[model samples]
Target: MSNPKIFVARLLGLDVFDPLGDRLGRLRDVVVVDRGLHQPPIATGLVIEVPGKKRVFVPMTRVTSMDSGQILTTGLINLRRFSRRGAEQTVAGDLFDRRMVLVDEEGRLEHEHESVLEDLAIERQRNGDWIVTEVYVREVTGRGAFGRARGQHRLVDWDRSRWARGTEPQGATSFVAAHEDLKPADLADMLHDMTDKRRVEVANELQDERLADVLQELPDDDQVQILSHLDIERAADVLEEMDPDDAADLLGELPDNQQELLLELMEPEDAEDVRRLLEYEEDTAGSVMTPVPVIMAPEATVAEAMATIRQTEISPARASLVIVARPPLETPTGRYLGVVHFQKLLRYPPPEPLGNLLDKDLEPVSDLAPVTHVTRELATYNLTCIPVVNEQQRVVGAVTVDDVLDHILPEDWRAMDPDQTPAPSTENPAPTAGGPASARGGAPAAPAAGPTTNRRT
Candidate 1:
């Protein structure tokens, strides 16, 4: 019942428990996630060793906390419930599980970059052997060259394929499909055409990222189908590579059950982000702002701001609009103090303090405030997007309308912009740290950045 305390090292070899306090397995490894901003880490999933040497899987849900010399389980797990990936899923023997992982070595879903094996590739090796089949690689694997050896189908072995069902491309009566391929390009296009179907019939397919990109440009409905159809982990990798907001929006359209399934399947933070946006009304700023913003202290130099932004993993903080704030943001009102459009920040001497060039009269709003107030005030000031302040006046979040139309009122409601707070904005999606950013009622808000912590590789 008390807060569980354990050493990070204990995570390596400690025995893990289920919610029932029953011994489920020994901890095989730890999954570390990197959030661009400083947020607590999440254990994507666990590599567990159950009793009788019957190894099975246990996800974070079955975990309670990491304790000294042990892992607290949810007391609800039984190793019999799930199957674990064994030795065949290795990089040297199993390339299928190695491709999607950015970190971690044994096919555990930890981060986006580490999915090495899911969505396997099909290319002619100079030796004349082709890598036509693969299992969905685990999210974690140590560095090493990987390629599944030739077998009956000449690619993925059935033993591996059964376990990596969703990770590999489906269909085809035989391996001859990819082997007799017209061309990778034509195959890519052909699969794209049937992407909308419940099942795609392809003997050989394009690699994961390439296939994901082609699917992205298709209609929204199509993208969802293809994404959902991929192995859970590989699908997660594609989503991880995508803009969080866009991924969040797309996931929101799915059924609640499916939503949870996909979230459980993804790396923890990515799932949390999607769920976070799902909390806001699809049309509100809460749904639009990427949780990771690059905020700087008003007192800091532009150079400091640049350093912080560059450290970010995905979106570069330096080249975008950077809002000035206090360090470790103590309050919401603190965020509204100033703004420095990216252009203006670059024009000033890097050594100069950001406060020197900031537009100090920052406009902010309570997240719960009517969207109408935001639309009107921003329109009057010719502001692109405004910050959302909390009751304490600390800036918590911002909103935009680049994708969501609900944030922007239709022509019929444009006249009502300046009116008192519109009650309709209160249709609660979820509670946001910053209310929501103002929507686009007229002109667009500046497509700038904030000081949220997100990392891009």
Candidate 2:
């Protein structure tokens, strides 16, 4: 199968494509309904930009096919005279809102496309027509877009061998379409939508890598629950799927019982990685970074680097922090050079020496250092990520702005205080029978109005 042609609307940073090769306006944003009643989410139309004339707002419903370079629409809408709305943010922005398929590293979906994960699985029923199944795990007390997807489904029948164990994959490049009912992208959306309870249920049922992707997008609470739901053997399989820092972060949030359970569930290598990350505090650079990094010896060839990247897992942080070090030191010192971006590395000649590509005049920080330093550096450079190094210059980890935002923002961001900060709950529960209301807390029970038995009509 050919790769699903995906169009990165370069002009607008929006992704739009039709399977049938039609041009549609970029997807600007989506409205999700996670906390309200009867009304479903209303998808916003997009403004298709034209060269000289006016732009038009094309309703997403007009989309007939979504594949590769363009989005096929039901009918052409002349958007030449279109007006702009405030919701036309980039697709990256929409992905971080926590309520849609498009999500950011912080586990929030910025866009809320109601149609995401709306798979058309063809379940054969002995007849010609196939069963169109929408695969999702339902939940009670769930929040976010998860309200629409809550239930226990093992997805036991999926072809695991197709997704893994392949030298050259045979199905769709996206492979998302291979499953009649599920797609990685759609499942990615469900990862953000599921409740802690339901997420755990789904986590236990998927492949480790698949589960890892979902868990990576979940909050601490949900991460713990999902990990808890899996047996140690199965949980370990998924644990290996995540980046070390993420695995550490989730394990750190689990109760003692669950933490131990997950650790035991993990393989020695994965367990060791988490152990290393857990060695530091949540606010520390060490805790937030993965000790496992892509380090290059100064003598290595650029071709070797390319081969390595293709072989190992690469994270957003890793893409930004490619450390070049002298072989003598496990951790490069003043000898340690600055980081080179993945693009730069890829662009360099394959035969170039690592030393030639190393940027020596770089700032380095200790893993034990505060995250604020990383944040400050990122702010100064306008970088999405920064690198952490030891005193000897050995690269220890990379810090991402997304993770920084996660660290700064509280879980219940809705309950902000007067200062626009998350405030502590001011409510106090009512006292039980015979318990003094005043003593039970809450504005001193209005001073109890002692001896107020006087009947002054």
Candidate 3:
């Protein structure tokens, strides 16, 4: 087959084999060395992830052939673990998703302009080494008219654009899309495993909403570490994007002074909810319930309710039931009427008003309800979430089954790698019983989160 220009995204994860056809490992990265300002970087070797351990490298000179099927090596692989030298750059690991500047053909950068390294255009040279000649750069621009803004991609000569200075990468969304399917929890766990400096690098790239979701999944220490790296204003913005309960839990991990500082910097409405959550005992229903959920008026039509759900971007657990209340759907929800479950909405016509379908008899738990009682109530009703109300039956928030599990399960439960099957927990039966409750609507929704890097392409 003729040599085709390949992208870094296409090269990663391909199978590698020896000349004898022995299966070795999957291709992990492409090592390259910059030649000079005139010539683009030249591929030096390939980094491969071995069967069960560290990544290793093989010089391009050892390869007998390279193709989509697999890389046939000369069988002279260097078994030494691959550690990047100061001058070396690896395609997938270092440059694939780096946020960069878009310099026009005249070499001038647009004001506040941003772009990301989508892929590298690698072509084979006569000397047998593949070299990067151009980059697939994607510009972040406003979408035409009504649609959401996004990346506009095109290939460009490598030397035209300079690396963006001091800005965090704008590549997390595209990077996640380029990689295999990833959940927020998975990405958060990966961030936790990285060093603090590395975590900051990745954290800087994510949008506040995505970062908030990942912060919710991470351990308290990791959450605090990431927040510390962000400016107070940005940190507060991220906290506002998070579920109030999750935000409260994270803020609780910080010293009183730091917590107050961030809260002061936050939008008052968002801060009030988190502050209210902080007031409750850690193990109580009030503390665990999310302050933000879909709350609709009893007279809301199914279509209206659906529209509200769409606008909120809430999780399935939060969306499974539309809390019907007396007007003023905001926090301290006016007299709670009942709930219209999502399943019931599907059964009724879209124009049907929720007031008629409200399950008025379903009792709302008090803010003081303990975790044990809360879990039992969820199990008894087969509910993904249950509303918590005050003395006058005003809805405060809803506690999802996952929140209960987070409190009951071992502190390190989320830290465990997903690929490794966890041993059955011998201690608690609450999570075991509540697990199915949380998974009521097929798989629980992944925490909506997203990560990025320095100028590299």
Q: Of the candidates shown, which would achieve the greatest TM-score relative to the real structure?
A: 3
**Candidate 3: clashing pairs of residues:** none
Ranking by TM-score: 3, 2, 1
- Looking at model 1, residue 64 earns an lDDT score of 50
**Per-residue lDDT of candidate 1, residues 1-457 (tens digit):** 2323222222445677655667666765433322212232233455566765543545555555554445776665443322211111212122323232222244343333333333332222344322322233433334445643221112232123222234432344232233343443344345545534422333113334444445434445656767766666556666665566667766876788877777887668767766766776644445565555556677888787767656646344223656677766532324356777766767888899887888866555555555555555566676555665555556655544333334553423322444645454444443344533322111100111211112110
> What would the TM-scores of all predictions be?
0.44, 0.48, 0.56
Q: Across residues 1-457, which tens digit of lDDT does each residue of candidate 3 receive?
A: 2553555565567788886789888888888875655678888888987875557888877766666557777788765556554246677767765667866667687546677776776667776667887777778676657653366677777887566776432344234434324678878878888888878767766657778888989988899899999877678878888888899998999999999999997879989999999999878788999887788887789999887766557788888889999877887888888899888888988899999999866677877766666788888899998888876678888889888888766678777665765664434345355543333221100110111122222
lDDT of 2 at 230: 68
**What's the distance in Å from true for residue 272, model 1?**
2.9
Query: Model 3 misses residue 69 by how many Å?
Result: 56
Candidate with best lDDT = 3
What is the C-alpha local distance difference test score of candidate 3? Answer: 0.74
Model 2 alpha-carbon drift over 4 Å, by segment: 1-198, 310-312, 328-335, 413-457
